[model samples]
Target: MLFIKRFLDQVDEKPHLSAVADQLREITYEQLCSRARRAARVIAKISSEVMIGVAVNKSADYVVSVLAVHLLGRTVVPLDSHCPISRLKQMITSVDLSLCLVSRCQEDKLTDMLQASIRLIYIEDAIGEEDANDNAESTRSVEEEAPAYVVFTSGTTGKPKPVLMPYRALNTLIDGMAKATEPRGTTLLYASQGFDVSFQEIYATLCYGDRLLIVTDAQKKDLYALTEQLSKERVTRLFLPTSMLIPFVTFSLYEGVTLFDLSEVIVAGEQLKVTPIVRRWFKSHSRCRLINHYGPSETHVVMTCQLDNEPDDWPDLPPIGQLIAGSDAWLLDERLQPVATGCSGQLYISGRSLALGYYGMPELTSKSFITHPLTQERMYNTGDICVLNERAQYEYKGRHDRQYKVRGYRVELREVEVAVLASGLVDDCLVVASQLGLTTSLILYFTAPERGQDFSLSLHSHLAATLPEYMLPSFYRGIADIPLNQNGKIDTAKLPQVGGVRPRLSSNYVEPQGQLETLVCELAAECFGLDRIGANDNFMEAGANSFTLISMLAELRHVLGHSFRQTDLFEFPTPRLLCGNVQRSKEAPESKNSIASDTKRKLRSAAIHNTHGRMRGRHA
Candidate 1:
């Protein structure tokens, strides 16, 4: 509440200053406040404390809608517009939401998914354009414990649970951020709106009378474009999840450039594991301060670990660092008693930054958020196993429930992912323990290297050399990119299931005819460790996974004196068809990027196209 009041005060002082910007245009502080006030008049008519959804999108109007809803003391629900239609419906039903605010870009799909009983107000439509018939609301005292925002996160029982955070928590967070960052500059709101850090970014930007820039959906998918935008805008601060940070840094290094204006880089949503690339980034970049921030959705940001210094300050486990203002961390054993230094315990956070509790789930709320034994203050059980060091700093060990027994020895999947990242070949990796009857298989999913580069074999070799046999994953799947949730965390639910039926090739063969076809055959045969030379050999059956296919294409480009895309393998798996495409690529060097886009076109021309199905031999 204090932060909100102070933010408005700043806005009043600098009414003409640029407040927020998207990809297209910018809005001044005066327009933002005037629209928020008009929208507040409309929102005041709604019943008090009713849940209202603010669709997570990159629009200035969405920001205005959020501030307007807060003015009426109604709880704002940050919904992921990209969530499954069915899940969105279920959430609407659970929360009894009758109204939701959305941007024009998201209106069509959401309206189609939503029931007629629900109302969708376009953000621009909510505010009065000409200031006509304004129904101003009377001033009232705000309650200290009233819920301000409810963020839904995945629970252990496979359900989306909503956590209600009070206004005090947000105010404390904004105050902390105002104190931590520089007094004035632009801050990027690039993470999903549902993410707690996004709230920090929005309010903190306003508190400093600074500019707020929302990253468009297109820029988020492309690292080069995003960096260019950030540099172009001269954004001084950015908060990215660790998953996105590594790739952006890697692409920056590959391009041999550095951002001159960015002053700080804050990474969270995953463990800050030190890698060779991380060391190199620190060594090379001296202007930007690298910070490792840690907090659950329940506690707002609490701890920070500075990573500017290199190897000597880093250990196997990165410290979550010192506590934030008005926050306290305790290391307690299973019995809720203090543990000795260096001993592992469940970390509990007690502070004004705590969320009120889970909405509509009283039992869950009571179970997780409990009273501290000594202080009698409410505390949240983080479910994270942490160890206190001699310096009184807390280090994140892993999740309490992330441990699994493999061959009678405990394995931490975080350790596995950390090791994989430390190898310097992979950027983001996920290790899942898939059950197969009585035994569990540790399956590793990783993103392949950039086009025209090969690293899967080297990654496998590195894992073997580093870890014991029991700790190693049985099946390694290299994907083009790692799937991420709306929160920018790994989407575990979307990972490929293990132990599925493996496709087989039929008993058919078509020998290579053309020179390009023969060369492709040899490359595929050598890359997959197979001796068979046929035009219709099933790539999957020949032990060629996605990672090997990229390498195969890279090798093909080198030998043929032309560039072939990684996607060309999937579109034209048959040697004859792929060879024909390669010859065209050689002839049309100017259209290299478009050469990959012609995948479906080439597939349509083929007599038989198996876009995803296995290519059979002559006989079944």
Candidate 2:
């Protein structure tokens, strides 16, 4: 392959350049290539396509082992050392692994997981410091389509899919990235090695001759420390899933923290919901370019991007932009025909990035990577249903199977469910799309907020105001917690069956006397999906927290000619108290125009001038 040889040539040219830095060790380019070549020599003796499983911690040795596999003209299966022992066994069995390369520390654990028949070689013992016996003599180099590695992704079905990639596809991606970004002096933050996105970070950094810095496992869980480290190191490039980014902003982790002249940051893997705090952070650190990246494991690292122009781009649905250099996107309807632009369709991708299909599962591979009607090219069908907007940007519309038609109205259960969780009243939640014979319904499972206050009434009331009656959940159950599947996603199978459960309002409370107070409480109850509003319950913690909702409340207060401060409503959303406060108002109700004008000015000014450092953290 072009890369294996090119990597060696680069090392020869710049031997002293830093290649990998992890925890307390740093490996130079020369050492990397030398070790890789030595390891490759050992790998060449092995039979099969040279697919070897690697089990190493976040260390320089782990990086060398990956490169070594490449040098041997064989694919490398990089396994997470920290994954469940059972998962490791399953992967080894599926890949028919010839050998495993692991550090001395993981030798015992590897032996426990691997079968007696399989070989587990220690890295320190297997690849010694001696120079590799050269392979440039008689052996002919293979072509580009040679397998590089097989990445296993958590499957929706029971088993995980081992997605295979060729050297050409990966090399093509590397070339495209070299063309898109700036220079090789970039320093990257390596978060997780198991995830494909981390691979993207690894290759992108090396190809550009940039420094690759690995974040420790402990640092990964601690956002405050991670952000501090990122700032301290002056890291220029980073790749993080949206789920991780949200909580970082929510907790004000960036407060008072000065960014390390960050040049570029790429966020992907999950839907990005950039909040107000994130927007302010980006504005203050305007030099950094926030890129919204999208793609599945099969399509290499990224397929599309919606570049961030402002910080506000974070909290909304970031558009999955146009296809990359060698890739083509076909948005097809149910009949497999190209749908009209702006119409929702199943997205299919073709070209180099399409994986060599799932490992061993030929049937599944054939089903997903099918031939295109007109082009005659094989394209991988992405189950995600998406709509191409007027800008030709792809706006994701939930999964095709996730859409449930309830009472003649097609509903996106995720949107409604996310709205509920956004209220902050629910600690955790899951929205399940299920069909009982002819009837379609949404089953919601949630855990109440930490204060032990039941939010059943308020959430339903708030949802009613924003959602159509038919779109609402037929059943909402509060559980101590929603169960997780083996792969860590919400497990729909484990959700309790709601067969005979009757619909019931969570709370029934009296209204306050003053008209202003009564209306606000009613509005709160409606917007929050609750049956009744309570005086003592904190509105912010109820998950009804957001700038948009605050804006809406201000609009309503102006329309009713009520003297309601946004924070006052936030502080006292309960009926009786708000009504009393409104009734005893000595100041006249400000004009609707004046109120709206002032609120807009204040929010914009606050956002632009929000220099206060507040430490906050949120889970994605």
lDDT of 2 by residue, 1-620 (tens): 26555566566677798887777877788776666666666666664456888787767777778887776667888887655565566677778886877777775765666636467666776568654353233123656787888887644343456888888778777777763545555455555555666667767777666778777766655444666677776678777655445444433332346665577777775555556656776777788777777777778644567455566645466676767788888899878899986788999988888889888989989988999999999898877788887776777776765544443233456666766776777887777756421134566778885545666667777666545444456456778778887888777777776533223333344444544444555445433434444543334333243322333344344334443553665555545555556555634465342335667657644542332111111100
Task: List where candidate 1 sits over 4 angstroms from the true fold.
Answer: 46-49, 115-117, 132-140, 179-183, 308-317, 402-586, 592-620
lDDT of each: 0.68, 0.63
State the lDDT of candidate 1 residue by residue for 254-310, as single tens digits.
445587878888887666656565667656777878887877777878888776456
RMSD for each of the candidates: 13.0, 13.1
Measured with C-alpha atoms, the lDDT of residue 583 in candidate 1 is: 63
TM-score, predicted candidate 2 vs. hidden true structure: 0.66
| TM of each candidate vs. truth | 0.70, 0.66
